[model samples]
Structures are given as C-alpha cells and as structure tokens.
Target: MKRQHSMPFGAEAVHGGGVRFRLWAPGVATITLQLDGDQELPMTAADGGWFELTVASAQAGSRYLFRLPDGLLVPDPVSRFNPDDIHGASEVVAPTAFDWSDGDWRGRPWHEAVIYELHLGSFTASGDFAGAIERLDYLVELGVTAIEIMPVADFPGRCNWGYDGVLPFAPDAAYGRPEDFKRLIDAAHQRGLMVLLDVVYNHFGPEGNYLHAYAPDFFNPRHATPWGAAINFDGEGSRVVRDFFVHNVLYWLEEFHLDGLRLDAIHAICDDSTPDIIEELAAAFKSVPGRARHVHMVLENERNQARYLTRDDFGRLLHGTAQWNDDIHHAFHVLATGESDGYYVDYAADPARLLGRCLTEGFAYQGEASTFAHGERRGEASAHLPPAAFINFLQNHDQIGNRAFGERLCHLASPLAMEAVTAVLLLAPQPPLLFMGEEFAAAQPFLFFCDFGPELAQAVTEGRRREFSRFARFADPAVRESIPDPNAPATFETCALDWSAIERAPHRAVLELHRQLLLLRHQWIVPRLAGMDNGDPRLAMPSARTLAITWRLGDGSLLALLANLGDDPVDATPPPGQLLFATANLDATTLARGRLPAWSVRWHLQPGDSR
Candidate 1:
C-alpha cells in the first residue's frame, strides 16, 4: 500500500515546463515516445518494465503515443485524454485549465444521500456532459442530492453502457472534451449537487484494450472474470496493476473534483488474498486530500458482504463501503409483479417473508443456501449492519435494461402497484436511488446497446440470446428477432429519454408524486435515520403485508410511512396523527376511517408524539 514517489507514468507537465513521458513495458528491447509535432525519442530504462523520458519543449494540447517493442504505436494505457478515439493517439490535457468555484462546498453526509443514477448518453439528446449540465438545477429541484453517473470512461464504440470502457483514465470521446466534463462538475457543485462516477475495475473491454501489449502481466491468466481475465491483484506484476488502479481512484477524486464513486460489480473482481483490492481501494480513497478524502465509496456486490458497508468506531467506511442491496429488488419484484422467473424464483417462494426480511435485515441471504446459486451458501452474517448500508432501488440500469425487452416497472405492474412499490423505495430508511426518467415515468426502454464490428456484433447478439434463453420469452425465435439488435443505432437512440413527456399528464402526475414523496423524505425521514441498523425493525408485518415505521426527527416530531403491499384492502387504524401524505387519492372519510386501498401507502406526522 506504499505510494510511489517517482514521476507518474502517463504524460505529465513538469513543474517548470515541458512534459515528462513514462510507460511500464517489461521485457521490451526498446521503447520510444513520439510527440505529435516532435521527433520520436527513445525512452530510458529504469526499473522492471519502467521507461521514462522528459521533453523540455513538449507543449500542452499535443497528442502522443508510445512505440512498443514490436514497433506498434499504442495509446498510453493511463491516458488522460483521447482526442481521436479509444484506438487513436492520446492528447495532453492541462488539468488546471478550468476555474472551479466550489471553494466552500463540503458536501452532505452519506446517510443523507438521495442518488439519481443516469447514463450521460441517454440522459439528454446531446448525450454529453455539457448537455447534462443544463439539467443540474432540475435535479436540485427534484430533491436528488447526488448524481451517480454511469461509466464515462473511453470505450471502443460511440454507443455503449460504458461497462466496456477500455481506457479507464480517459473520458469517452463521444462526450465533450475533458474541459467540458469539468464544467459540468463545476456547475453541479454550484447547483448543490454531488457527482458520483461509476467505475468498472473488474475487467477491461474486449476491444481497444492495449494493456497486454505494454504490460502482459496486467491481468491474471489463471483467474477468469465474467467479462474476461481477472485483474492481477495478487499474482506476479500485481504490484504495478494494483497501484495503477488505486492511483486511478485517487486521480478521479482529486483531478476530476468528483464527490464520490460507485464501483461496478466488485463481486466479479476475484481476489482471495487478505486486504482485498476493495479494502485497498477504500483505504486509498480515504487517504486522498481535499474533498476527495471524505468522499463516498459505494459498491455493487451480489454477495451482500455487509462487512464492507459497516462503519468503524468513528462512523467512517475508511476500509470498506456501502453495497447495493439486490435482495430488496429481488424480493420487491416478486412481491410487486409476481415475476418468479430467473433469479426472482428464490424470493417468489416466500415474498412476503423475504421482503419483510429485506426490510428488517440489511441482507436477506446472510449465509443462507441460495437456490439461485444451485444450493450454494452465499453472503455472510450482516444482521448487525445499518439500513443506510444497503441501497434499495426498484429500477436501476440493470434492473430495467437487463430484461428480455428492457421493460420498465411502469409497464409491468399496475399504476397502483408502481406507486405502492415506490413508497417502499422512497420511504425506507435505506438510501434510495432513482434511475433517470423513472421520476417522470418516461416511455424509453434502456435496452442493451453497443457498437462493434459485424462479426463481434453478431457474436454478441448470439451470446445475448444464449444468456436470455433461460427466460421463456427469449425461448422463441420470433421473440428473439424482436429483441432489438445491440449494435443497432436505433437501439441506443430509442433509450434516449423523451424529455417532452414531463410537461404532459400521467407523466406529470408521476413526477409530482416523486417530488411530494422526496419532499416528505427530506422533511421527515433522513434526519431520524441515525443509529438505525438491521434487526431494528420498528415495524414489520409479513402476514398482513403491512408496515409502520416511526422515527423522531430533530425537532421531536414523529414521522411514519404506513403501507399496504398486497392487493387486498384492509382497515389500517393508523395511530392518532396528522395525515401528511398519501399515495392514492383518498377521500376524507377514507382517511378518517384509516382505510388502506389495494396497494397503497401513506405518511403521517405527529407533532408532539415521541414514541
């Protein structure tokens, strides 16, 4: 975990003048650095695989590429800017060019985070950071404290989920330049919004990844991940690769001025050694300076490892961090729509009990043998973890886009059911994340789309069919043809949200519902979530499909969300309190009788009651 004190590997501007070029290429007989407007210079050898050269006349905004041992010119592996594209030369970016005005912004605590996850490509028609900047005020108005952007790292194609990003350090060329991206961050901070980037560390993209050419040991040959070879965290040459990634995390926080990071699929990052890369990353990020030091670190892990989500005695996730709670989504999906297919089969068996458990415990599995994993025991004991440690969401990028047809929950369930499920999502003590366009119930379907060569694209199509073959819909050839080609431009274009719908009905109603609910959350729930943990369910009613959670606010008022998750209506007989909000349009007599309609919920506030 020792920090390297030598010059950085990529092209960096020296303190006085010019740029210092460095690369890590072991076993190479020769390595050369070629600037855009300058002659090719041979790099001097340092330690194992390390090559360095300093050009006293190198200027900013110039492009460069490294010549490999075999004479193949390759882009810098840790490039800051790739002006041409992922497969082209890397550009020199002056990091201090943009003037930031977030001098006094310290950011809100993690518990108070209300995340809005959105893909920059699909967030607006322009599909760039500059376009997203126009909506920062809209997000602030929508009550989202943080914007968890999907991966923006440079990938091979123009259209992708960004999971296939090859250059981890370079922003996507499809988006505006690095300076434009920085302007978006600066604007977001000015509008009182935190930006959390989603980073992919599990595997590099299949195409445009040239790390193996320069550093053949960057990936572990023995270990395979879902996307490809596992990163060489504990193997030979791991020190360089591990340090490379650790420094990248710090680089994003420090250089980009980001408020936090949401790590993508860490469970796929297989590391069997002590002080795992996750632990290493968390510790490194915690040690960063400025706003980067106390920035948020979130994980997407299926294993439900609550140990990462737990805070130390000082209430800090210094060595571990918060994880996405799939248990809640799986359980809620089964309860809301009765979709028992695929992974939903496990929770469908006893959805009420499962949902209740997910509500009470941070993880529903918690070392239990999972039928989905072929009776293999998964997860660890996590009943002691806090609710804030688990992020509950009804629809995220995967939940909506990974389906056979990429249908939203609004299309799957009844309107009443959607609202009811949303209450559980927004009103829960756990941090809630809303996917873009869901607040307004946009009709766009976020299908899995990409752009690749015909051969690889066909292979991906066939592979997708094989992947979804487990579902009955994909079992038919006709349905498979209608499944939308991932490489088609139309597939990506269709996912772009139709912002016009927000000004219309039904959508406006849904949007207003979200606003009201979030306003209620900010006014009631977030302040009272302190010291709340798993197995501390103040209200749990599995059999009746009902729940009542009461909490005392900073001013001593009690707030609660009384909910009915089932289709059968029942007499709630709520506690004596003032009715603050209701999901359904209830009449006065119904409110007086405390009658809960099928799939409905309500919020109540008691001014003087503390119990």
Candidate 2:
C-alpha cells in the first residue's frame, strides 16, 4: 500500500501521519534539506518559487534545516517546529486533534476582562508554557478572566523579551514545543479562561533572520525603523508580504485556537498602501469559520487615535479592538511615584489630567507639545467608543523593565501608594491589566534578556548602555553600576515567582487586596456600570481635582467610581445618594463630611431603593 500526499506547505490533516516540508527560493538554483544530525536530503523544485519534499520519516520531533546553494544550512526561515534551538526537536502539531471542552465558554466581554500580563521565560523557574498552566487556577480564583501572555514568537536563541521575534508563526522553542503551547491554551480554555498571545509584526529580531535573501523587497526602502527597514507593506510584491503575516495571524486563531493577539508597537508599522494591510487583515480574520468571533487585535501605540479603535469612514474598525492607554498609566505613575524622566517628563502630578483620563478617553496633552518628546503629541476624541476600547495598566513589562535599573513599582514606591492607584484602575470604566507578581507586590524586576549571536549580543549591550546615558542622573559610573546588569544570572533568577511569599503575612494581605478588589468589581461593578448611555456628566466638584462618574446599568442599579490623584482629601458630596462602599477609612458616622484619602480610589454603589 502507498500513501497519497497533498501540497507540501498547505497540506491538510488526513490520518495524522506525516508532514510534507516545502520552501520557495526562485532566485536560487538548487536547495537541500538538512535533516537531523547531518543528514542532507535533496529537494525537487516544482514551479513559481516553490520546492517540495515528502518523507514519511518526517514526523514529530524531526530536526531539519534548509541548505541553500550558497552552502548556508540555516534553520527553516518559516520553521513551524524547532526543538534544537532550545534543547530538542520541532514536532508537527495538528490543530484539529486537540479536544476542547470550552463549547460553553463565551469569553468574558471586553468590559469585564482584567488582564494579567506575564513573560513566559521569566515567569517561573522553568520558564515555559507548562509552568504557566500550573497557575491558571490561581488566576481564575483571583478574578482574572484573561491571561495576556507576552510575545512568544521565535527569537534568536533560548531567552528573550519577545518584542524582537523574527519567525512570526513559530513559538519560541525555549518556551516549549508548539504542541505544549496548544496544551496550555486547551487547559486555559477548559478553565473558562481566555488566552491572548502577544505578537510582533513591526520588525524582525537582530539575529537569526534570512527572509530578505529570498525577497529583498520584503522590506521597504521608503521607510526605516530603529531595528531595520520596515516590513514591505507598501513596497513591490507587498501582497505576498501581507499574505505572510495575514496567514500567520489566522494560523494562531484557527490553528492553535488562540483567543486574541496583542500586537507589539503598531505605530512603527508604516503602511501607505490602499486598502491598508491592517483593514485587509481584519477582514481576513472575520472570514475564519468557527474562530472569527473569538479573535481580537490589541495595539501598543503612543497615538491615542480614535479611528484605530473606531470604525473606518465606512464604519469599520481597522483591525484593532484596543490600544494601551499610555496617558492613563503615565499620569497615575507620575502622581504615585513622582519620578519624572525620559518619557515621564510630559507627565505631571495633576489630578485634572488623571480625572480627564477617567471621564474622557485621553489626556489633555494628547499631541499638545509634550515636554518629554519636545514635539506636539495628539489623540482623537470621539463618541464611537466602548469603555473597554482602552487597556489601562500602571506597570507592564515596558513600564518597569525599561527603567535604568530593573526596579518594579513596589521598589520605586510604597505599598499604600500602589494600593490607592489600584483602587482607581480596578474600579475605572476601562479594562485594567496587572503585571505578574504585581497583585502581591512582587519586588523582582523584569530585566531584559536575550540569546543572540556574539556580535548581536555586544551590540545589544552597548546599545543598552547608550540608551541609559540619555538620563543625566543615570549616566554617572556609580549610577550605572547601581543598575542591574541585564545579562546577569541574578536578573533572570530573581524574577521567578516566590510561591511561598504568597502564603506569608504582608504578602498575603497584598494578594488578598487584589483578589477582593477584583471580586467586588466582578460581583458589583461590572454588572452595574457597563454600557450606560445616559447623558450623565462625569462628576468633578470645583473644590476637588478628582472626578466622579455615575452610571445606571440595565438592572436599575447605579454605580460610581471616584478617581483621586491629589494630596489633599476630596470632600465630595455624593449628589444626595447613600454610600454603599467607601475607601476613605470613614464609616457611616463621617461619610458626609469626611474626605477621601490622598491619592486614593473609592467605589460606591447606590441602589434605586436606597435613600
């Protein structure tokens, strides 16, 4: 008996037997397959930049490389399976094979999601996908509805922050094999939790990249990025370039059944092509059969443009569901920690700006001559937006790790300071994100890590030092020494979760504060505050800088979230409504005359029946 095979690259799953590997190199004369351990298999070219090789021996855990005629035995430029890069071999995974039990799970609506961001390589001692699965129950129990895993796209070697991934479709081998990742997603879904994988499309990593050789126009000469030439979105043969990424996006959703994606640094993706790649990709994602409803795109950009979050001129969203509200994080961080340098220069300790972020979707400084950038910064303000259209986070991978020293918010400020900040963030009318270990005041810093070739390694080190030199206070030798060495073993080792600390006293309290806060939000806030359309003005008393918002849900319940970023107390009179829950440390005795704590957050729910 003989076995029949389909097209090499786009083969469909039959009896789940073997994989037919393929590569496209029109410019080259010949191609060779570098199989596991020095075994080279010659390939036969068909036509139109395509080559095919079918071997029944190519099963799970097969190590293979592409041998170009130039004698370059590089790993598959688009390798779906990579085992040897970290420790083992790449395995072929079938998406249809996994039995998912999440048929009853309609993911939590965007407004109700509280995202927890984590880096797989530094999250645990083993630092892999499997390690993250072990803690999913804890997240669910803690009231986290979604896990926004940082970028796991393939980088050069074993460890990375994942913003510099080159292989867009392949998961980093260091994290675990692709199947292991599928299992992690399956396990998360079974628990009624959603998984959002971070992806990088702006640029490739500095090392282990070879796509340009096959197609130089894959990058644009018209525009350039700090990393390299921008992806060929507007260049010649850009349709294929766009197809490459569009396919990758669908691959994760359709192939791995990932719930959503967090795109890294979207502002850097300069595309001028008509029917822009962004919109085209959005349409393509919507075309997927069973997976269309579950996919979402989260962008990280300095621009708070409304069009990115809203529909196009014809009433269509441009492949984006949410964007990081940098202004909100900056305003709260500056007021809480009082460290103003680098990009923080534009941020002030103004309670008005903080209040504006709560009421309006953006800050007053939106494109208004930022002191930090020395240029006009701007954002769009419009009505066609839901509250969940913005993702608010006080501390993320960039906020804490990009500092001169890898110091978390806990190390930079007091626990009380963060507690007050958390109050507003959790109770606000937007999606809030908690960095890993932040819920418990985890003190470890998320230092930058990479496994690049020696040349790239030296470049990275020098570039990092040069970057810190921009801050005069951090330029001094002593100050430089104080900054944790990004490459040091201790930097990576210390970032792991201290499981025992969660069972201790002060740490337990911090963790409980987060858990209880989230529980209160889920049980009371979200159910009452979502989708309110009345012309209720955001409450801002003349005497206080903080702003209060009141909205009536469908269930005839009214909820109010107060945001305070000032030093003095806000003696707010709650519009003839009774207090349900207050954080001013005052009970019913002084509720009317007492003031909210300095830099505090308070949430009060007044039912229609209450006086």
Candidate 3:
C-alpha cells in the first residue's frame, strides 16, 4: 500500500507484522539500517529522496539507527522516541497504542483561555512528566483553561530550556518516555484543561544538531538566527525542509492530540516565502480532517505582528491567532518596579503614557520608531484586532529568566505593585498567562539553566554573564560570581517551584488572591468582555501610578477596577451599587466614602442603573 501522505515521516507500525522504516536522504546514494544490534537491512529507494524497508521481526520498542556511507550511525530525525538520547538508536513508536481518556474534550475558546506557562523540568520537585501530572489538580483549581508547557524537544544533556532540541518529533528522554508525557496531557484533558506545547522552529540548538550532517540543505547558510543557522524555508531544497516542519505540526496535533501549540520567537524565523511559512504552517494544521474544536495557535513574535490574527485586504495571512502582548508586560514592569534599563528604557521613559496606550492602543510602539532599536519602527497597529488576540502576562519565562538573577516580579517589586498589576492582567480584556509558581509568589528564582559539554558549557556561562553586564545587578563586584552559570546543574535544580511555599503566610495569601482573580476572570470578566474590542474596555489613569478600567456588561451591570501601582496613596470614587471585590481593606460602606488607599486594587459594580 502506498503510504498515507501524512502518516508521519519516520517509522510506521505494521498492523499484523512489524515496523516499517522510512528514511529521507536525497543527498546520500546508499542507506543501510542497523537493526537489533547486529542485523543490517538495506532499504529500497523510493520517491522524494526516500528509502523504506519493513522488517517483520522488528516489533514496537525495537531500536535502530540509519548508517551513512562513511559508517556513522544517526538517530532518525523524525523518531518518536530516542531511548538512548540523540546519539543512540531511535525506537519504533506506535503513537496510537496509548489509551487516551480526553474523549470529546474539544478545548475551550481562545477568549476564555487563561494560560499557565510551565517548564516540566523545573515545575515540580521531581522535574519529570509524572511530577507535573501530580500538579494538574492544583492548576485546575487555579482556574487556568490552558497549560502552555515549555519546549520538550530532545536536546543534548539532562537539563535544558528545551529550545536546543534538534529532534522535533521526539519527547526529551529526561522527561521520561514518550508515553509519560502523553499520560500527563491525557490527564490534563480529562480535567478540561487544554495542553499547549511551546515549539521552537526558527533554528535548532547548536549542540547535537546533526541535521546538517545528513541533509546539509536542511539549514540555509544565507541567514542566521541568535541560535545559529536558520532553517531553510526559501532556499534550494527548501520545499522538503518546509514539509519536515509542517509534518511535525501535524504529528503533534494529530498524534499527541495536543490542544494547541505556541510558536516561539516567530520574528526570528527568516522566511521569504510569499504567503509566509507561518501561513503555510497554519493552513497545514487546519487541513487535518474532523477537527472538532478550535486548534489555538499563539505566537511570540517580538515584532508584535497582529497581522497573524487577521487576513489582509487581499485575503492573505492566517486569522484568529493570538500574539503575546509584550507591550503590556513591559509597561507593567516599568510602572511596577520603576527601574528601567536595556529594552525597558523605551517604555520606562514614558511609562504612564505607554501603560495607558498599551491598555487602549494595544501596542505602545505600534508603527512607531523604537528609541531602543535606534529609530527602527516596531510592530503594527493592532488595536483593531479583538482584545483576545493580545495575550497579557505579568511574568513569563523570558521576562523572569532573562534577568541577571532571575528574580521574580515579587522579589523585585513591592507586594502592592505586584498585586495591582496582577489584578490589571487578569481583569484586562486580553487573555492572561501565568508563569509557573507565579500564583503563590514562589521565592525560587527561575534562572537560565542548561546542560552542555564542558567546552560549550563554559562558552554559554561566559556569554550569559557577559550579556547581563549592562544590568546593575551584574555590575556589583560581589554579584559577578553570584550570577548563576547557565550550564550548572545547580542552576537547573534551583529553578524548581517550591510546592511547600503555598503553605506559608504571604504566599498563601497571594495564592488565594490569584485563585480569586482567575475565577473572577473565567466567571465574570471574560464573559463580559467576550468579543469586545480595545475600545470597549475603558481606561483612565488618574495619576501616573493609578489606573482604572471600567467594563459595561451585556447584562447592564457596570464593573470598574482601580489599582494604585505606586508607593503613594491614590483615590478613585466608586460608582456604587456594591463593592464586589477589594485587594485591600474596604467594603461597600467604605467604598462609598469616595477614596481608595494607595497601592490597592478594588472592584466596584453598579447593576447598570437597572431602571
């Protein structure tokens, strides 16, 4: 039988026989499969630089690697499981063998999504798939609709942020077997939680990246990314390269049954294709038949391209996608901490104005010349896009981990400021994302950590610390040695979230506060702001540090939230029917007194003048 055009690229499990192996090596003349340690089976050449061979003796979990002409063995680029890491044999996996319990769990709508981003390695004390699975209930109770897991691609070594993965098709062996991750996702889906994986497509990691060794055309040497060679999307032999990436997308969604994928650093993806690689990828994802629910795909484009969410006049670009709202985070960080340097300088210069604009205009630098980028215009006006297209977050992996010490917002900013910003984030019309341990205000720092060879490791350490030299923290002579080495096991170990912290005093308070805000978001705010534009959500900054956003509900109820983000006291008169919520001391009677305490968030509601 001819292979199904989309039946994945590597190994296929035969129904009554064994495993059929497929290898794409257009450049190589002859290919041999080293099977079951000793037996060598020569593969027959097929179309499109493809070679295939079926060994009836080889069963599921059997390991093998393709042998090159010079006699070097390499794991399958599209292997579902690499039992012995990247340098070892790739195991034949039957993706359909697992019993999934997420029956008919057609995921929630994007506007209703409250995403919690987590790194599986550092999210739990065990730092594995099962460890993360144990926390599913904790996350569900926290009222998050989506769990955006950090990248899980099999990279070199035991610990990593996962972006360095060369194997796009396999789960990291460090996180346990591929089935373990499936179990976690199944469990999450059983609880009505959507699982979204963060996928890196711009460039493969430097270490253990042998794609060039076999398929030298996989990467276009013409372009470069921060991570090194960019994936060839428009150059010669780019068609197959594009198919490889697009195939991975189909495999993740169809095989793993993941609810969605978050594309990482899409701005760094240098593709000159007419419709754009993203549009092509989106079309391929949507092409899968019998997709019941919305397959939510979000993007982290530094350019803040809202065009991804909507088609153009010529009916191009993918529509209904969400983009990360860095403007909101930058404005919040600057306004909350009052310490601005580096890229923060741009927003810090006019924080109040930028914060106001971020709330109202979507992107503060929308089509405006970026002073930080040396007069380069950044982003496009996306205020016309639905507010849900903008994902708001107070802290994400990049923001917290990029810092010299990886000190969380709670560590750097006042409790009041954090609380106020938290309220703003959850209450905003945009869908909100929470970093792992952020809800409980976990004290553990989320430092950048990785595991690489000694030589490359040293380079990473030196480069990481050097990048932070501009920061005031790294400037302190005492702090230079304190900068956590990215390559150290200790750095990876320390980033694990302390589950015990939730039992403590202020941490407990913060957790409860987060739960309440998230519940309020799902129940009241999201429904109220559903399909609402940025213009629908009204904002007022009474002072440089005080902000109030009012929403007129469809049910004729008015909801107003005021937050004081500064040390000084600020006041806002409540339009009272009742004071529904308050992050500080005050009640309906106190709210009626016409003043708000400094550094506080309060919600006031009047049943929309029921007359």
Say which candidate scores most in TM-score. Answer: 1
TM-score of each: 0.95, 0.90, 0.94
In the range 1-611, model 2's lDDT, one tens digit per residue, is: 11111223532333456667777666677888776667688888887677777766666556777777887666665556566662233345444545665555445556667899999987777799999999999999999988999988787676778887776767887888777888898789888788898888888887767766655667887898887788989877686678777877778776677778887777788899777776677776677656425567787877666666775555345567778787777777777778777777776546455545544544344445666666766666633455667788888999887876667887877666777777777766677899999898876777876666777777776677777876888678667666665555566676777777788877898888888889888887777645543314355543545666765553556667665566676676554444445553545654655566565556777777332
Q: Write the residue-wise lDDT of candidate 1 on 1-611 in tens digits.
A: 11112226798888899989888888576899888836789999997779999888786888898888688889998888897788788997777766777766676677788999999999999999989998888889889999999998998778899999988888998998877877898789888788899999999888888887777788887898776678889888888888888888888887777888889998889787788899999887777776433488899988877777776665556555577888989888887898998888788777766776776677889988888889988888876676777888888999998996789888788888888888778877778999999999889998999897788889998888778866777788777777888898999999999999999999999999899889988877776666444424555563357766665544466666677888887777676477777777466777788888778778777776356
Candidate 1 lowest-lDDT run of ten: 1-10
lDDT (0-100) at residue 193 of candidate 2?
A: 81
lDDT of 3 by residue, 1-611 (tens): 01122453688878798888887787787789999789888899888778899889998889899998888888899888897888889998766667777767787777778999999999987888999889999999999889999999998899899888979889999999888988898889889899999999998887877767678788787888776678899998898888888888887887777888989888999998887789888887677544667687788888977678874553233643688889889989998888778889888777867776776667778888888899899988876666667788989999999887899999988887777788878866678899999999999999998888899999988888777776776786567767888987788898988899899999999999999888877777766664344435577788777777765554556677677666776666655556556766555565667566666777766665352
- Output the TM-score of candidate 3: 0.94
Model 1 Cα shift for residue 354 (angstroms):
1.9
Looking at model 3, which ten-residue stretch has the lowest summed lDDT?
A: 1-10
